[model samples]
Target chain A: MTPPPSATRPGAAALGLAGLLGLLLTVEVLPRSGVVSADYLPPTSRIVRALAVELNDRAFWRALGDTLTGWALGLAIAVVAGVVAGVLIGSVPFLRAATASTIEFLRPIPSVALIPLAVLLFGTGLGSTLLLVVYAAFWQVLVQVLYGIQDVDPVTRDTARSYNLGTWARVRHVLWPTALPYVMTGVRLAASVALILAITAELVIGSPGLGSRIAVAQTSQAVPEMYALIMIAGLLGLLINLAARTVERRALFWHQSVRGEAVL
Target chain B: MLDVRGLRKIYGGHGREVEALRDLTFTLDPGELVCLVGPSGCGKTTLLKCVAGLLAPTSGEVLLDGSPVTGPRPGMAVVFQEYSRSLFPWMRVRDNVELPLRQKKSLGRQRRHALVEDALEAVGLTASAGAYPWQLSGGMQQRVAIARALAYEPEVLLMDEPFAAVDAQTRAGLEDLVRKLWQERGMTILFVTHDIDEAVYLGQRVLTLSASPTVVQDELKITLPHERDQLESRADARFAELRTHVYAQIRAAGTRPAPTA
Candidate 1:
């Protein structure tokens, strides 16, 4: 039973790796062979060497750390604010209705569009980057948590009430468990959104991070280094996504969606 | 003792008014088991919800121990039909049973543990104490629900068609378990079901309810012996007579026309 799927996984990985290598080879050859100018598009080998050099550079490490710090801080703030607000708003019908139009009006406004206001208010600092990141990520978590609270079974709510559970006890025992899966999903989405906004703020608002470093490299015409920084940002996004999924799966092991995967 | 005096529940207002229960009245003495049987769409559930204080009646009131019920009273527990929904899926069997006790804040840790153990033992689910509700079968899940109610040590236990979702064999086993538990605990139980045979076999006095906008049509006393086996008690002549009588009452109520303005 296990052998067939396990065997197919390696086969699938080999195919994927083969495809990735093929694309890398195409990019490697295209510029060097003069199909595209080397000045505009650096060879994969040059980019790889630049990446190796950047990995050893102290300044590169500092910039990477700064970017991650901004992202982590923004995500933490958003999660706390979103969960609290979502629970409060979702539990009360009057509050939910009152805020529905306001939430709708505010939610769809892109965080990048707030970059000008953030720059005007805080200038090019961690605050500016966090403003956009938190704004974007907060909506992700808030919407998911709202959906989660609404999804709570009426029977379960009635059971809690009939048991004479206090407000805090009911929230902890019934509401929290019911809303957790949604919170996790929100966190997963917010994690990526936070990272994207953090980078965007650094790039556009001239904040001190990897995105700013990429901007500086581009301005200095260090094409290989610029490509290397972009690649690193992509890799970081991938790692954050993987980490978020692992956390979600671990936290929601009791949930049907997670448990159903195990059965298969 | 519990008294439901002229209980009326009207959902919505004015033109959209849906009358679920109209002039429903019944009384239960301490340590007595009564079953409420009715048609499919009857207000049996609404009645139980009112008595449980989960919902307020539009008119009249439920008096528990001579106090008019305003909210969920401390000495009452309910086992709903949807056992899967009622039991917290995240908690283990023992934890689920211990929840109400923890909410009450009267029992210490050791006492709570002892009660959980006793309740699980009574339901013959001591072995599955560490398991989750979803991990158990439907019948076992319902047993966990009953165990939770038992651990509460309520003066009144209201069951709302609790065994309706399980298989026939499982339902019969659950029925017997309820009877055994009722006999042992001697707590006032109000069991609601649409199954005539189940009402006849379980209740000391079976209350037959009319169709939609329900009112108590008849109440029949069962004189069967306390010591009952599933086969012998159900096969008894008195059981058949009471079952037939309740069936006729329900049938007549179902065919009856709605009252004109």
Candidate 2:
């Protein structure tokens, strides 16, 4: 059997640190050896030095805050609205049938395509960013919730009914339990979309965010700074995904994925 | 006590009326364990659903304690064959068992906990009360479903092919558990099954339904002793005789001509 998580996590962390150092060394060698252009991939050491300089700048911190706040607000709104709407639609076949064609029509339209319309309606600021983020996140989460609810077995519903479960009780006890894994899947998926849309809204429509900061660095010919900002955005996406996964694991420890893991 | 009179069910799709049950009539006394046996498509399931108030009869009435069953009453609980689908996958076993207790007006939290514990213990699931339904084997999950039903302390418990999905060994064990529970709780149980041997072994009386557009073809009273063991019950002369009698009735019902106006 494998070691306990307490021991495994520290070892995993060390491995990840080693991998980062190896990547830094390789990138450092590439530019000096003329193996790759420094302009495109600015050596990792230079990027880290630039990242240190940007960390002390008040404006960089402010922009990061603005982007993160917008992402958080947008994701929260999408989750509440999407899950509620999904449950309502999933539970009622008639409602799902009536609105399905409309959802399908709109889902394929990318959030990037909505930048101009959002800017027109909400102006070039947090409002536009929030709008795009919510739009990007909603459809994915909604579909997952619908599938989760739909996947709930008819026998469970019948069992709930036999127990004299009221409408609300059935949703709380039966429907929610059966649909949780699907909802978690949707949430994890939506987190990435939220990050992408937040960045895109900033980059395309001139909102104050890491994306806009990168644009500024690019215009100034600060290649290292630009690369560092891009790395920050990547890290942000990783953090969001990690956090969502952790929450999913804790909440659904009884779920199949967790149970399938060999116990210590 | 429950009564069924002139019960009819017709499947309306595919441009042809498929009558599942035709004027089925029967009466079940309180504290009786009755097994219903019939061929496939003989409306054994339809009758149980009607009696449980899950499905409305096309015509006629299912009376519960002299009143018509319009919807699920608090006095009834059901155990279905699909154990995996019958229990919520996310909830712990204890929560699943306690769910039905939530609907009972008289059960406070303390009382409910005691009842749930008792039911889980009775079903040999106390050690697994914290586990999820999916974590257990098929037989274990079925036991949890039974625990949920028994916890509710309903006056009438309906089981629809409750053990058909399990292996023969598990089926026999569950059959004995059902008999013990029925006697201990004094709850009226209407068990529907396609297995004649199972019907004979578990029930105090067996009700045989005719093929398609099912009606009660025969009702055989089990004169065997109450305390049952799987090995001895099958080998006993009385058990063999009762099984033979029920088998013959079901076979005859299977070949009988469809009723014509």
Candidate 3:
């Protein structure tokens, strides 16, 4: 049954904002009151001022754009590659078994560990960042897609087969719908991982992004500016996560989990 | 006509193999409505899957109109027991019903729409056609599954305990709906159930199956009037006799020890 619109309140949002303001006030007070070294940990007000200055800089915008470009491109490639590979491998028993060991072996190797190889192969450019981002993000999507495909009910498969649906038809009509929710979950996870790896690659490889900019500020002892850039990176992560969640909720409205949220 | 000749299905390999079906043999004449009744674990599902061409028999074959059924044929449709799983949750009721017709490619867009509407009307779900399967009641969802099968216009329909998940009242309603569909379409149907009364009420003939390593234990002609009512027909003396007869066979089959290799 659908509940009245007025019955649902924005209690969570109000509480979250209150908590964030309290945390920011504490951070601002700690260094200003000499509870911590202001040289290393500047007051929140100074960081905010540094953020305002950086926001107006043309170089800051270009670096932000480059980071996002790497994230988006790497995420796009991983999703397409993962879904195709996952569907193929998941549907075939022999292929699933053969690849299981290889997947498990490769999945655990940290993407950061491949930084040396990536730098050697692609130098300090978008390619280096993409290499790490794609490698990390690819696993998130591949595993989720595989799980999603496997989660398809056997009865549905049989029902499709009984109706004389061809391989392509079955995948389009049955398999895709059943696996979509899982794919969305995979994409959400991959989105976050892609951002993390993109920043890490830029930081380690001296690429032209916010991560490299933050590294430069730190080396020059621009503490407040470094904190501002770090805060921006954190904010970007939050924005990406929120956007992924919104997409998932909209796409999987028919799913029980999403429907349950609406009812609650 | 559909012929199942000595069908046997074994699961797993070598020492751990499970014999699901053993030497199962039967035939359905065109327009015949046959119900297979058995004890739990009697391999009714395995047999139905083999006949639907969804699974291969370890030995023997299923022949549909004199041709061996190697895979799913265009002339056959199946309504699986789990309606929730059988019907695509992502699609609307009408879309689910239209899917098989679209896949057939014989029906154009207009014909497909007419068939979907007709099937939904037959299942008394015309008003709910636009709703998703999850939005409907369990009985309604099951009806959508049936509607999907009906829209296919298959010569042979295989139903594996299709009404088992519904309540008694809903199950009775569906059983009547099925009988009405059968009489109207004159399509051959192979209905499987562990419920004795269901087999006796809905089928022209009832086939009883043995437990584990299942084989057809007995086949009995229902002999009930074609224009049977749920209240009157179920209360009939013949209905009581057939139900008792099938129940005794199932109980006997259940009590017997499974055969050793």
Candidate 4:
């Protein structure tokens, strides 16, 4: 929900930034000095120039849009489905008991294990990427939502019931507050997972995204352009993480875990 | 106004049956302030839960205004021991108090606001009405819970060791607050506690319960003046005598072996 306290410490960000710059310098020196062949690993300067060139290309922007569309759509579907399923299953004791074994059994299978099935069903398109992305992210949310519902205190539940609050009211006020922090936790994890699955689907299935562009560059022996596309993917993941954390902190400002982060 | 007739609660089944209450019978007339005193584990909580309609009895029933209570209804309200758990930390004190009233649909927005303000004023928490429960001290949090219950305006109020978690100083203040509220509101109150002095100090009649499988062992009537100062009432000879009697009953109950049903 929050960045580590070490990151918040005075001058820690500056020191981290310096460390990143140092790594960049080392890479620049290693490749230019031929310690690693330039063809295999381009120097930092060449990668940056290529990144600037790619930014000017309309094809690069389109690929970025396609990748983001897959991640966002998959994450949205997963969140809504997971929360509905989690709450419905959790609140009903009989339902929870009946489904417990099935959930446990299905949760651990890797999403990529279904890559063959995804390609067979939807071919090399956004649909193929979406299948993998949604599958990878749905369990992250469902498991956390279950944990949140279980964490609701018995006394609090009794308080709501004692007040004669109707079932819907109880869910809105009591259950929602207790489960929200966990749902945010689930979303954050899912966001990252969704991105990974999206790129993996595109690379393996030859879908139109940054991942496919990188593959094209690799096959064509355009080392600098390939590195540039990989950098763009890293930047996209970083931006998504930042957005997720911000949403979590804002939605859960009342929670203890997020309240402490506010002071920092 | 409140009647608990032949209440019995049995937990578990087969190999691990626990008969917490053999039978508990009591009545609180309108505006009656009765204290239920028992040993630490004498199923006081179980009894209170059943009376509040939060738990079903193994046998017998709780009646409010002569109607059977199958579950929590608008005519009844309860204050729990764990105030921190009872109050929603996500809501401010005012919202916490207003929540129950909001369910009443009959109350307009202005009326609901006024009731919330009045409850907060009664509990002397008007200034902290804007603060979250977690931001307040332990005693203040309990006051918020009391306000929430008060705002609901139940005809019969059930308090389950409501002051048990507070310190002695805070407990005395809360006891006086409760006394004032009962006198002002005229609601039938059944307060369950283990403290002998508190039982004697607060109740018109104190009922002492025996160990599990529990039953009412003794009843003592307190003859204190209507208007009482905590220090003066506590020092009175009659208060001492009544508390001693309840104390002895509790001690005996603690040592007595469970009888075979």
Candidate 5:
């Protein structure tokens, strides 16, 4: 049964505000109390002020835009590449078997470790950064999609076939919907990883993004600015995760877990 | 409208072979409703799958409308026992019912809507058209699955223990709903079940299968009247006789020794 509307909204609001306050306390009150060295992780007040100052700077916006572009471009590439490859690999048993060895060999090699090769190939630009993000995010999504397609209930597949639905139609209507929840989970995970790798690539390669800005602030000994950039990175990650979750909730409201009831 | 002749299936394994079905033969005319009763693992499902063209029999053939069934035919639809999995959980009930029409591609939007509405209303699920399958009770979900199958307007509907997962009361109610649909639409149906009473209650003819390498043991015509009620039919002398005959056949099947040369 659906939860009462009045109770549900206020409860959600309370939880959200509590979470916001908890983060505020961590960033502001604790540092203001002189619990740690403010030079390294300055008080939240200074960070907020720095954020306001940076918000007006054209270079700051450019760098933030660059980071988001890299993240979005890389995530889109990974989803397209991973889902296509996963479906092909999963549906074909012999191919899956042959590629199992190769995929296993390559899947474990850290994308961060490939930064040197990526740098040599593309140089320090958006291309190189996006490639690195795709590298980091693809394997996670590919594996989840592979398992998701394989885990489709046989009865459903049979039912679809029994209705004389063609292979593509069956995949679109039956396989896609059944595997979508899992794919969304994988994509959500990939978004977080993309954000991390976007910044990490920028940090490592001295690219024009938030990570590079943070590195520059650190080297310039602008401690408040560095803390401000770190806070911004954290907020970027938080926003990406929240966006993924909201999309998932809206798309999969029919899911049992989302509907919040036990099927008897 | 449908016929299965000498259907056979064998599952090959490591140094072993499982003969799931052997030399099974049955036929159904249009508007006929048949119930297949067998013990667990007796290959009733394999038989239905063969008829539905989901699995190719090792050595026999299924014919529909005088044509050999090679692959899944558009004239048939299946209602699996797991209704939750059968309907796409992400789609609304109306969308789920409308899916088959989308596959047909011959009907326009208005016609498709009418078909979906008719099927839903027939199954008493019009009120839940906007609800997801997972949000409904098990019986209601099963009804949705049936509605989906009915929406296809298939010549033959295959039900594999469609009501086994529901409560007893709901199962009885669903049986009645199915009977009403079958009488009204004249859709030929081949229903598989493990319950003997259910086989007799819902079928115009009850086909019993022998255990292990299942063969059609016997086919008995349900001579009971068409307009039957749950209470009166269960108590009627003819219903009792048919139920007793099916039960005895099943019991004999369990205890009967293997025939040898």
Candidate 6:
């Protein structure tokens, strides 16, 4: 039944890599052909050279650290707060009803819109970045946690209750495991949003990260360096997403949905 | 002993109130294995939930050992119909069986371990103890669910159509397993199912429930020998007679009551 067996299908990562290389080659060619000005969109080769220089600079390393710190701290706080609050609200009908509309209203308000207030409260520092990152990521985790708790199998819940498991015991043995996969999904989503907000806060408010570095290069007319910094930010987002996925797979090792996926 | 007294339950709030169970009453003596059989939509689940203290009755009460069961008592355990929904997929079979024992505060580590091992052994699931519930077959998963209930060491075990999802062979095996466990453990069991043959095979006594608004339509005391065989016992002429009688009764009681304005 095998059709010739002469050719193998390209894996997903190889296809993605080929597409990325194609895009890079186009960028490298367009600037030289005068289709795009070299002053604004530098050739990909020039951007790579600039990136090589930036990698050796201590200040660039420090800015990368700052970005990472803001993302990590903000995500940790948001996850803890979201999980606790979600469990409390989801378990109690009254609390869920009381906060449903309020969460819906608050969740839709963009984190960037809070920049003015953040600056007024914390100035252009880590606090400003933290404020935006936490605000943006909190809703990602909280909403998922709420949905996860809601999805707890009613039969299982009744089984737990009929067994006379105490409140804390029920939460630990039954509720937590059921909600864990959803929480992992929430964390993965939150990780991406947190990275975005961290960079945005640094760029718009000058809060010291790769985004601020890109802004500095732009103002100084270092077009190639600016492009390199933007590239670094894109690379950072990719790494965070990959890491989040890996962690999610490991944490939910026993979950049916995770276990059922074919390994690539 | 467990008692369900004049239990009535009405579901829905607004103008769409639907009566599920109306004035149902039953009792189970200690060490008795009783089967509650009914047709579909006969409020069997509603009745079982009320007895297990998972759902509150509209007009009556469930009393366990002379005490009113306002909520789930520590002395009861339940095996639900949907094994896939009832067992936590993330926990291995052993952990799933052991978790409820955490509620039995008097149980020490040694006793808990022993109980879990014994329960798994009883269900012939010792080898599958390390596997997740989802990793096993459907019938095996139901066995794990039963193991969990058995491990809980409850005074009364409430099973709501426990073997309904399994194959015919698995259903027969589980029926025999239930009878064996009841005989050995000497604990009360309230098994609910829509399968009349299953009720006749597994139960010492069978109670038939009518369609909603429901009531206990009839009760039968099984006269077959206590030691049952899936083949030999079912082949007995008395078995055919008993199941046929139950089938007739269930069909007669299957109609919905006339709507009273």
After superposition, candidate 4 runs with Cα above 4 Å error? A1-4, A261-264, B258-261
For A1-264, candidate 3 gives per-residue lDDT tens digits of: 433354465786687789999988988999989999999999999999999999999999999999999999999999999999999999999999999999999999999999999989999999999999999999999999899888877888788878888788888988888889989989999999999999999888998899999999999999999999999999999999989988987887787776653221
What are the per-residue Cα lDDT tens digits for candidate 3 across B1-261?
A: 899998999998666999898888899999999999998888899999999888999999999999999998988989989998888878888988988787766678998999999999999999998888888888889999989988888899999999889999999899999999999999999999989999999999999999988888888999899898999999999999999999988888788864543
- Model 6 agreement with the true structure over A98-141: per-residue lDDT tens digits: 99999999999999999999999999999999999899999988
Superposed model 3: Cα runs more than 4 Å off: A1-14, A261-264, B12-14, B256-261
TM-score of the A chain in model 2: 0.91
Two-way DockQ contest, 1 vs 2, winner: 1
CAPRI grade, predicted model 2: acceptable
Per-residue CA lDDT of candidate 6, range B1-261, in tens?
A: 998888999998887999999888899999999999998998999898988888988889899999999898778889999998888877888989998897788999999999999999999999988888888888889999999999888899999999989999888888888998999999999999999888999898999988788888889999899888988888999999999988888888876562342
- The candidate that achieves the highest lDDT relative to the unseen native structure: 1
- Candidate 1, residue A162: CA error in Å? 0.6
What is the per-residue lDDT of model 4 for residues A9-78, given as tens digits with 9 covering 90 to 100?
8698889899999989987999988899999988999999999999999999999999999999999999
Candidate 6 residue A145 Cα shift, in angstroms, is: 1.8
Clashing pairs in 4: none
Q: Tens digit of lDDT per residue, candidate 2, span B1-261?
A: 899888888878878998888878888999999999999878887788888888888899999999999999998999998998888777889998887788776879999999999999999999999987887888889999999999888899999999999998888889989998988899999999999999988998999988887888899999887788888888999998998898888888888775652
lDDT of 1 by residue, A105-170 (tens): 999999999988999999999999999999999999999999999998999999999999998888
Give all TM-scores, in the order shown.
0.94, 0.90, 0.92, 0.94, 0.90, 0.94
Local accuracy of candidate 2 as per-residue lDDT tens digits, A1-264 = 333475578888898889989988998999978899998887888999999999999999999998999899999999999999999999999999999999999999999998889989988889999999999899989999998998767777777777789888888887887788989988999888999999988888889988898888988999999999998999999999989988988787776676564232
lDDT of 5 by residue, A74-98 (tens): 9999999999998889889998998
Interface quality of candidate 3 as DockQ: 0.54
Lowest lDDT sum, 10 consecutive residues, model 1 chain B, at B252-261
What is the Cα-based lDDT of residue B122 in candidate 1? 100
Residue A257's C-alpha lDDT in candidate 4?
78
Error of 5 at A112 (Å): 2.4
True contacts kept of each: 0.72, 0.66, 0.78, 0.78, 0.80, 0.84
Candidate 5, position A6, lDDT: 54
lDDT of 6: 0.89
Please give the DockQ score of every candidate, comma-separated.
0.54, 0.48, 0.54, 0.57, 0.61, 0.56
Task: Please give the TM-score that candidate 5 achieves against the real structure.
Answer: 0.90
